[model samples]
Target: MKSNRRQFIKISTLGTGGLALGLSSMNLNGINAAYAANKNEAVSDEDLTPYPTYCEVCFWKCAAWTYVDKKGEIRKIIGNKEDPHCNGRLCPRGTGGIGMYHDEDRLKNPLIRETKEDGTQYYRDASWEEALDLIADKMGKIKKEHGPECVALFSHGTGGKLMGHLLKAYGSSNISAPSFAQCRGPREVAFTATFGEDVQSPERTDIRDTKCLVLIGSHIGENMHNGQIQEMSDAIDNGATI
Candidate 1:
């Protein structure tokens, strides 16, 4: 309880990763033996607390339950049965999202760049107030030097919506998200040009009911498209030709 940050981080990282390593090294019989030996040490499913959440591993954001033991340690992640996107089964990435939580290298604090006497640059952890003040100061200077229109924003995910609004209110209309460059923008343009309609999120493809599932260069099952992959499987089971 009195451990320093480094000690706490080390203990947490090892504690989280130990299970993964143990399972990975064990075969079926070894796993069974290990489980039998530690049966009493294992937390019962009913005892573990379940928290409803959404997977942040990919854009699909499948709904899930994060199970935590009495000690507040993450036990596992499982898809919510009622979630339409997952249909009770999460993708591999979604199931493994706990790795992000226990990742040792993830940034947990703000850092500011500092230059040493040797002209070497390094990052030093800064307080939230310091970081915010520095950002405000820099933004003020930028606004004074160049018009706000010159400050273009590149964002992703739900947070991008708020960032876009902030940038626009700052007199900049140059807000862009990854969808514009990655796939959505081009796909929308092509679809509108050909079908005279724009494709929307939770796309209207209806892969599960389609007679023909065409793939030019797309890999629905191979990627993190959880819902689409499930639909593709359904289509194949129903005699749809790929």
Candidate 2:
């Protein structure tokens, strides 16, 4: 009876070892097949042009791939599939960046107003050095004569933020932005009053894991962020009502 029990134990151990070896061999065979297939597949240099980078066109700061041509010129931009923020999608503005870069109407150099008439202005080309000198002289004369308070500046967007910094550096207190007048100002004012914080871009909203989303006065359909738009579409596809 003891011999039979020992024999059973040995048989069980051998079966387990055989199974383990079979599974390992199967896994190795699968891996080799995949490697062989991949080795035979030809990948063109143009197809491999996309390289990882980051987008700064908006506050999203989405990770992206910049596709370059043979001449090393950027031909296209696409969101990185590895990015948690954009998740391999871009908005219309981000996609249109290529067009903007190649736009014929884009300003290549500094221009100065040569003549000003009733609601009309004519501009002429000027060197950056000459333009800066003229602007400095005029601003100095204005400050000396009418005081610094006489100059007021109105700006918009991230570019406006830079202008705000410039205005502060120039020692001007009369500076404002139209962000309040254009969009979500009342909501921002109320939220700030209640929470003691002002709303800002790239706000901390994890839309990916959210089951339900509520958009009040904000128009998700029109005034949409690329990430938000993609999230909304995914939510609908997953049978979550908007």
The candidate maximizing TM-score is: 1
State the displacement of the C-alpha of residue 184, model 2, in Å, after optimal TM-score superposition: 6.6
**Candidate 2 per-residue C-alpha lDDT over 1-242 given as tens digits, one digit per residue, 9 for 90 to 100:** 12232443454456546644754554455434434434543555555588788766666677888776555555667888777667787665465445545544457888998756666778888999999999999988988898877888897655777877777777788897766576657868876887788775544455546666676776553444667656655555555544
Backbone clashes in each candidate structure, one number apiece?
A: 0, 0
lDDT of each: 0.74, 0.64
The parts of candidate 1 lying over 4 Å away from their true place are: 1-40, 186-201
Write out the backbone clash pairs for model 2. none
**Total clashes in model 1, counting residue pairs 3 or more apart in sequence or in different chains:** 0
Candidate 2 shows a clash count of 0
Candidate 1, residue 13: lDDT: 52
